[model samples]
Structures are given as C-alpha cells and as structure tokens.
Target: MPGIRKSLLQLVFSGTSMRRWNDKMRPMELMEVDKQAHKMIMAWMLYMLNGSDLDRKDFIDLGDKIVLGGMYDYLYRLVITDIKPPVFYQIKANPAHYQQLTQWVLEQLKPRLQSLGDPFWKGMREYYADGASRDDLASRILDAAHLLASQWEFHLIKDLNPKDEEMDEIEANFIQGIEGFQDLIGVRELMQGNKASLGRFAQLCGQLRFQQRWSQTPRIPETAVLGHMFIVACYGYFFTLMVGGCKARRVNNFFAGLFHDVPELLTRDIISPVKSSVKRIGDLIKEYEFKELDSKIFRTLEQGGYFELSRRLKYFLGVDVGSEFASTICLEGDTREVEWDQLQTIYNNDDCDPKDGFMLKICDDLAAFIEAYTATRNGITNDQLQQALWKIRKKYQQVSLTETMHIGGLLADFD
Candidate 1:
C-alpha cells in the first residue's frame, strides 16, 4: 500500500510544475517541463484512487475515457491559464468563459491530442463548439490528464530503486488496490499504443535523477533531487515507524518527504533563509508562489474537479493562500504533544499526522547534513558546504524537537 502511494505521489512531482524561464526569458523544453506538470495532475488522479469513495464519485460518474482524458485536459489547463491578480482567483473557468483556452491548448498540444484522437478529446473539442455541454468537455479534460500522466517512467521520477522482487510486490499491490482498474493503468502513446511512451516517461523520470541540485554551487558527488528525496523519505519512514506513527501517519510522512521540495522545479532551490530573511519581501514571494501554484497547478486540479489533491498539497507545502501557514503551520514552541494535538484540531483532514510533520522536519534537516557530508567526501571544499555541515552538527547535537528521535545516531550512521 505504501509503495503504491509512493509511486502515485512520485508521478505527480515527476513533472516540473511549470516551464523553466532563463536569464533572457527564452522558454525551456516543454517535454520535461510539460511532463512534470502532467505528472502532478496525475498525482491528483492517484490521490483519488487512494482517497475516499465520495471524492472519486464525480469522475467515476463521467466514465473512463472522460475520467482519464478530462483529468489531463482539465489539469493541463492550469498551465495555460495566465497568472493574474488574486482578484481573478474567484472566477472559475466555465464553458462560456473558455473558448480562448480551447484555442490555445489546441495550438500547443494539437499534434499530441490529435494523434490520439480518442472520443474524450473529441468531446473536449466539441465543448468549444456552439451549445455543446461543458460537462462533456470537463470529463474529457480529466481523461486527457490521466492519459498524459500515463506517459511516464516511475524509475525516472521517483527517488526509489526497488529490487525486481520488490517491484513485483509493489506492482501487485498497485494492481490489487483498485479492482477492475489495473488494466487501465499504463503508458499511453500520442502516435498510438504501439510504441511505449510509458516506458519513455519512465526514462524521463530516471533522468531527473541526474538533474543536479544547486548547480551554481561547487559541489562534489553532486546531490541530485532524486537521491535527496529518497534519503529523506527513508528517514521519515524509519523515524515514523520507530515512533509508532499510525498507518495514515506513516503514509503521510512518506509522501510529504517525497514531495516537500517539488516546488524547486519552478523556484530553483531557494534556501529557507532567503525566503524567511527579508520579512515583507519573503511574504511577497510566498504570495506570488501561492498565486502561481493556483494558476499553474491547483487550478487545473480544481477545474478538473480534484479538490483532495489541492488541499493535500497546500497542507504539506505550507503554501495555503487561504490560511496563515498554508495548511500545516505548527505554531512555534509549546511542547510536541501540545503542538501536534493542536494541529489535529485545526486541520481535521490533513493526511500527515502532526508527529509525521515533525519527523519529516527532523529528517529533512538530517538529509541536508548528509548532502553536505557527501559533497565534502566528493571533494567539495567550499566554505558554504563546510558551514552547512558544521551548523547542522552543532545544532542537532543537542536536540529538542522530540524525545522520540535518536538524532545523534541517525547522523552518525549516515556518516
């Protein structure tokens, strides 16, 4: 079950949420970027499968092609929708309001959509025509999202590398999780199903492993997002397991660890100090990111009618535009028991337990230390890496986050 959830969450973050902008403002390749966005949309689909029945009823009613295609189309629309002021957030995309949207997507993804001219895509095109029901178009978009998301390679996107037998076990769980649905899950093709786009997507996800983090830095044995996430996930998993985290708690922590840094795909890895340093300026950046995510990510999920994923992402990332610390802000310092308990009362639906959240933070810090240690071992002798390692050792040597953590040994074992 955990493996299935991990695989699904991995798909969502697999796609970079938006196109990378350069110094001169020329756009980067859409294949990788678009793939990441599409995967995130698919993340919502996976979430639906993992979530409650009521949450899935909307898409289930619309039928399969629409469910798969419409999710893609609907989630994909978020990328195309321009980021305007918060005032525009209230305006939902209705059929009457989106003729231009249809025109734009057709222009961009025309070949891919056209090549795989399924009935769902046809319905989406029909919705743009006069008097056609938006309902059909909406469903088709979800279908498109699922189809596009299907074009993925888990090995590429996920930080995991399972053994053959382990993979077989995971696959069985993945299949058995949704009765009558395993056959539907696969890599889809734009030209047709003859070629293996799913396999290609897996390769793309695999390449993400090599996409270096902090490229500007003089790093040794450079830490990639792939390894970082995997280590953090393991740390969280083991820590949660040791602390007696509940089933839901473990899943939440594992997922949170897996996806906590996904926003770096767009923002590059803006260090926490920079985000929190300049008071109002950091607030402004946070504000901008919230708006952008809504436009570039959440809006698609919302319109495609996947609310659960939206809420979950906001909670884990702490970017909720609606609330102070997004959904998971733990008020600074009382005691772990009080703060964790308080969080439960505050956000009843949050998937990550308060304990899981704390454990994730601890593991996150530990992973940062591991990165520095690994980099230095690889011959990265920069003062930045040196200071990073020193500061982490100094701070964590005497811990206060929770009594359950064996922080000293955790770091030592990694060393």
Candidate 2:
C-alpha cells in the first residue's frame, strides 16, 4: 500500500518557488505551480468532454495519467529551471542530450520518490526514461491543456511586455499551438462556444491564481488559491489510492478537492478566524457562494448546452447535499449522504459513485498544514505562520487516515 510522506509532499509543493516568465515584465510573479494548477483544470475539463470517445478501459487510468503527467512535467521543470522553453525544446530535439538529462532527473527524483513504491517509480522511469512524448488521448489532452494555460498566462502579460523583443514571436507561437488542438472535442467546444461558456469557466479558474493564500502573512514562496486546490486534489487522489479506494471513488475525491474552493473565487478567501468570528457568518458566506455560483457559472454552462458539466460540478460541490465535505453515494439514481463509517462498510463500491468527504477534508487540512510548515521552515517565522503550524498539528495528532497512515506522525517528520 502506498502512503503519503513528507518528502513526496514537499517535492510536489516545490513548484511554488519555480518562477514563470521571469525574463518578461509582469503584474504579478507567475509561478510554475499556479500555471500547472490551471493546466490540470483545463486538462480535466478536456478529458471530461472527450473521455467517452476513447476506450472504456482508459477511464479507470486516465485520471492517474493526467495527475502524474502534471507532476512529471513539474519535476522536470524544477531541475531545468534556468533553461528557456525555446532552448529546452531545441535540446529535446536531440535524443542523446535529452536522454542524458532525463537520466540525471531520474537520479535526482529517486531519493524523494522511492517511498511511493516500485510500480509508480518504474512507471515514471518508463515515461521519461527514453525522453519520448506520448501520443495517446490523455497525453494529447494534457498537452493541449498545457498550451492553453500557458497562452492564458501570456495574455496576462502580453500588453505589459510591449518593449520586449521576443513578445510578438512568443504570442504568435502560443496562438499557433493552441489552435493546433482544434481537433480535440473539448478544445473545439471551448473555441466554438456561442456564449463561450467553457472558455469563461476556464478563465474563471485561471483567475484564482491572483488570489493569494494567507493574504496578510509573508512567506518565502507565497502560494495562490489556484495552486493550493491542485495540491489538495493530488493529495486526495494519492490518499484515496493509499487506502484502496475504487476508481470512481478516487476520481470523485480528486475532483472534489479540485473544485472545493471554487466558491472562493466568487467570495474570495475569507480566513477561518474571520469566518467563525461571528456565529452563522460562515453559513451566510456559504449561502452567498452557492447563489453566485448558480447565477454566474452553473446557469451559463447549462444554457450553453453543457448540462452534464454543470451537473457534475453541482455533484462535486455538493449543491444538493449542502456540504462538499459530506460523504455521499448515488443509490438507486438518488444521491444520499452517508456517515463515514457507513460509507466504508456499505457504499464503497464503484457503481455507487462514492465520494469520501471526510478524506477530502483531511487532504485540505494537510495541504494547509504543509503550507504553513513550509513557510516557517523557510525562515518566515511569525505569529500567524507559527500559530497555523501549531494548530494544524494539534488538530491532526490523533487522526488516522489509514491503519498505516497517521496524519500526526507524518507531520511530526517535519520537526
């Protein structure tokens, strides 16, 4: 059984410090992690749109590939941080040079990744060991997502970089690459939307990159709400796998993590202290979030013939159930909330389309803990960071995610 470890968690979060578009002038520092978060969101959207066209067998494993692919790209970027994209592509064209560089990356990753077990490690090796690109549906969708997300970021800074000599060339390349994926079902739908519903939804998610977490506190590498959601989603999936969740349960949990904070995009990230400062204030905030989400997002999609997308979002966000953190399963064509213990004993089957709300909450807390812990370790010590670390540790001291996984014990490794 796989388990979450400090090193692996830290390894994924390392992208927080990896800067993007460093050579160009920008309004805010665009971090690699935020870009990656946005990319995976788009990739998942594309996957949803075109997933049925592929083999049924692909459904079980496609989500894993998308998640792992994003991580693989992130790990590669961390090692080759100084290499420009154009220069890196040129190097990639040379098989010998790319292979050598890949081997070095494997060597670097081995120590941090060994804890994930041989199967996962071997898969990563096989993916990049030869320095070749995958051409399957999942790979194509991921590539398309990467291109579009990068183009989105480019648009943000395009006007600001008017004086940069490479700006025009870069913009042209982005447009060409994005248009190249027009054959994809999701990409084509996004591009051809009469109301631009899909495009608008994607843009809304990208904007989360501007909303920083812990807005009032300073940290070594400040993280955005967008990247934080991706981290939680990845952790939710990994933890689900660790405990032997079925494929549907795993997918449900991952998406639950990914969009858990979508309401925040409308309401903004209100700190916990403020939310709970007044009784029922949190409830009021949640009520407003649901209203805005229905009007601004869900209705737009439904009107644009994206009824399935809107329905899935509602299920993931628990619109009918009242809380995303409530364990639920579809029984006899009706969604029903189940207690954690009852869910484990009864509805933990693929056909039920079960989602582990308790598990997602744990993943969210873990992500937040790591954020606070990392900031303190990076020498940005202060009351807010220190207090956050302490409280999170205390909260999880006795919580066990699985028989082999104790949240507190895993966190203690940081000390």
Candidate 3:
C-alpha cells in the first residue's frame, strides 16, 4: 500500500512548486487536484448510468479509461497558458515544466491505457495525424475536464463571504454551465429533466467542492477538498482485488469507498482526534450530520427518482438512509469474509451492508496514513501530524475488535 502511495505521490502530482499557500496575489495550482475531481465525477456518472445493458466489467474498465483520457485532455490543455483565462490562468507560464508534468502523467497512466483494447490508440493516432477529424468522445472528455476545473473555482474562493458577488457569480456560472453543456455528455437526459435533483446536486457540489480535509494538521502543501476525493477513489480501486472476484461487487465497493466521505461534504472534515476527545461532542457531531443530511441534502433530492440515489449513497456512507445490517458493516474483518454471502443477501434486500464497506474502511484508514506520512516526509514539522502517525499505529496494534481499516502489512511497506 505504501509502495503504491509513494509512487503516486512522487510521480503523479510531481510539480516543481507545490507549496500550498503564500503571499502571491494570484494563486496557481497544478491541475492535479482537478484531475481527481473529474475522475470521481466521472465514476459517479458511470455508477448512476450502469445496468443499462452494459456488462459490469466493461463498464468499470471503460469508466477508468474515460476518466484517464479526460485527465490527458486536462494535461494537453496546459499545452498553452493564458495570462488571464476564464478559469485557470498563469501569472508566469512554464511550458517546459508543464510538458514535464504531462509526461509524468502519461507515464503513470500508460499501463491503464495499454490494458484497454487497441482501437483507443488507433483513435489517438488518427486524431493526431488528421488534427481536424477528432473523435466526438475526445471532445466530450475535454468538456468534462473543463466542467470540473471551472467549477473548482468554487473550492478556491469558498472562504470568501457567501454574500460576495464574486461567489454568487461563480455559483451562477456553474449552474448555467451545467445547464448549457447538457449536450456534451447527454448527462441531463439521465437526470430526466429533474431540475430539483439537479439543483440540490449543484448545492451538494458547492458544499463538498470547498470543504478541506485534515484541516487541523499543518501540511507542507495543504490538501484541498477534491484532492482527497481522488485519493479515496484511487484507494478503492487498489483494494478491489483484495476482497473478492465479483465484478459488480468490485465496482460497488469502489464507489462505496468513494462516497464514504460524502457526509463530510455536509459537515466539514473534523479531525477524528477532536471527535474522540469528548464522547458527547462526538455524538453531537454525528447527530448534526444526520440532521443536516435530512434537512439540507437528502430531502431536496428525494423526489426525483433519485430517492434511490440518496438511499444508495447513504447506505455506502452509513448515514440515516436506514439499513438493518448497518451494524454488520461495523463487524470485524475476517468475520465479514466468513459471512460474505449473508452480507450480499442483505445488500440486495436493502436491509444490509454494502458488500464492500469493510474493505472501504481499510482503504479509508490507509489514505489517512499516507496523508500524515507524506506530510512528515515533505519536511513539515507538525506535531499534530506526527501524533497522528503514532496514534494510528498504536490503535492498529491495539485493536482486534474489527480490523478497523488498518492493514497488517501497511507499516511494513512504509518507507
């Protein structure tokens, strides 16, 4: 696990300057964070659109390739930088650096691309040769990349006062852009013109798009909201083989891991140490999450045939959407393996655990470990993060209760 994370951290987002925040009048971030957002959003779209006569294996594979392709498009967009583009801009353009970053991304993604059949490369070669006879799929992918990057501006300025006209305009532009780009992916057709669900989704995007994780720790390069989403999704995919061989189950668990933090989208990412410091306060925070989900997030989307969407998301997240086997998700590790059949039965019954929840927990904790470990590696002398490491290791050693997302080989694999 650590080996995989080390490769990803050092190679995938390896920009020359990744310092989180400073006094520059204009902030510039590499598109790595937005790449994460685009991938997750695409996963979600495919998740919603699955079972429409598509083989589950093919569907998952195609979704991965599409997201990676969109990321490639994101890199190519950096082939040129404007002093003031509508979305991302460069006060100082660095073409060589951008090219280097693009090559790094290509190297990381090459394996995934090669695994897909050869026609994808054929499309690539033809498009490169003709220059004008580009594939429609590529254009839509570019559109997806732009959508994620453009809306990410919300995350950047989330600290601004909500009443600020700039925020209002940003929100307006996002809403309007989605409305206009319905043709790009035919996504609106999937929504069935349910403006109510779409409206609530826009609000949900705003809620999560700006919410930062690990806020208490002093990070050398601060983590953003969407960047962590990508991490969780990537971890989900990594663990897919460890649990089982069911194709749909693999995909299901991957998404379960993806939305595990979706509740934090509503309630901000509170540190677990703070939550555990006081039992009553922790319980209070959980109660607040339920209340907010009910009042703000869920109710708004419940009527749009998306009531099922709400239920499935909450099931994955272990929120108030209600499942009888929610407690089973908390059951210990190997226990889940033995009772796996029963869990699957319960899953179909909707009174049960997500087939992937237990594995999801492990991957989620692994993500926490990497976040803390990487910060320390980057020379951030943060006691909070240091303690985070000790506490995580200590708890993993002490706990036999449910294997609680801590893998035995994790520290063994650490650098």
lDDT (Cα atoms) of all candidates against the true structure: 0.46, 0.84, 0.50
Predicted candidate 2 versus true structure: per-residue lDDT over 1-415, tens digit per residue: 4678898888878888888999888999999888988898888788778875555457647866777777678777778888999999888989899998889888988887777777668888888866765787778888899988888888889999788899989988877887878888778655443448898888888899999999999987899999998888878877777777777787888888888999988999999999999999989988998999999999988877888788888888888898888888976557888887665667777778888888898888888888988888888899988888889889999998668989999989989
Write down the lDDT that model 3 would get: 0.50
Q: Give the alpha carbon lDDT tens digit for every residue of 1-415 in model 1.
A: 1111222222232333333211112222333333433443344344443334433333333323333343344334444545441212223335544555556666665444442234435654655564224344334344344334432333232234343344454345333433333333331222132243333322333344445666667764455564455445545644554444444444455556656655554455677667778868676766676777667556655564546656666665655333222224333321123244444344323232343455577777776765676667767788777787777777777664346444654454445
lDDT for residue 333 in candidate 2, whole number 0-100: 52
What are the models' TM-scores?
A: 0.50, 0.94, 0.62
Candidate 3: the clashing residue pairs are 362-405
Alpha carbon deviation, residue 168, candidate 2 (Å)? 1.8
Worst 10 residues of 3 by lDDT: 15-24
lDDT of 3 by residue, 106-192 (tens): 555545443323543444333334333334443454454355545554456456445555666657766776675565433553233
Sort order, lDDT high to low: 2, 3, 1
Candidate 3: where is the Cα deviation over 4 Å?
Answer: 1-5, 9-31, 46-181, 184-196, 242-244, 320-354, 397-406
User: Model 2 Cα displacement at 386 (Å)?
Assistant: 2.2
Clash totals, every prediction = 29, 0, 1
Best first by TM-score, ranked: 2, 3, 1
Name the better of 2 and 3 by lDDT: 2
Candidate 1 lDDT: 0.46
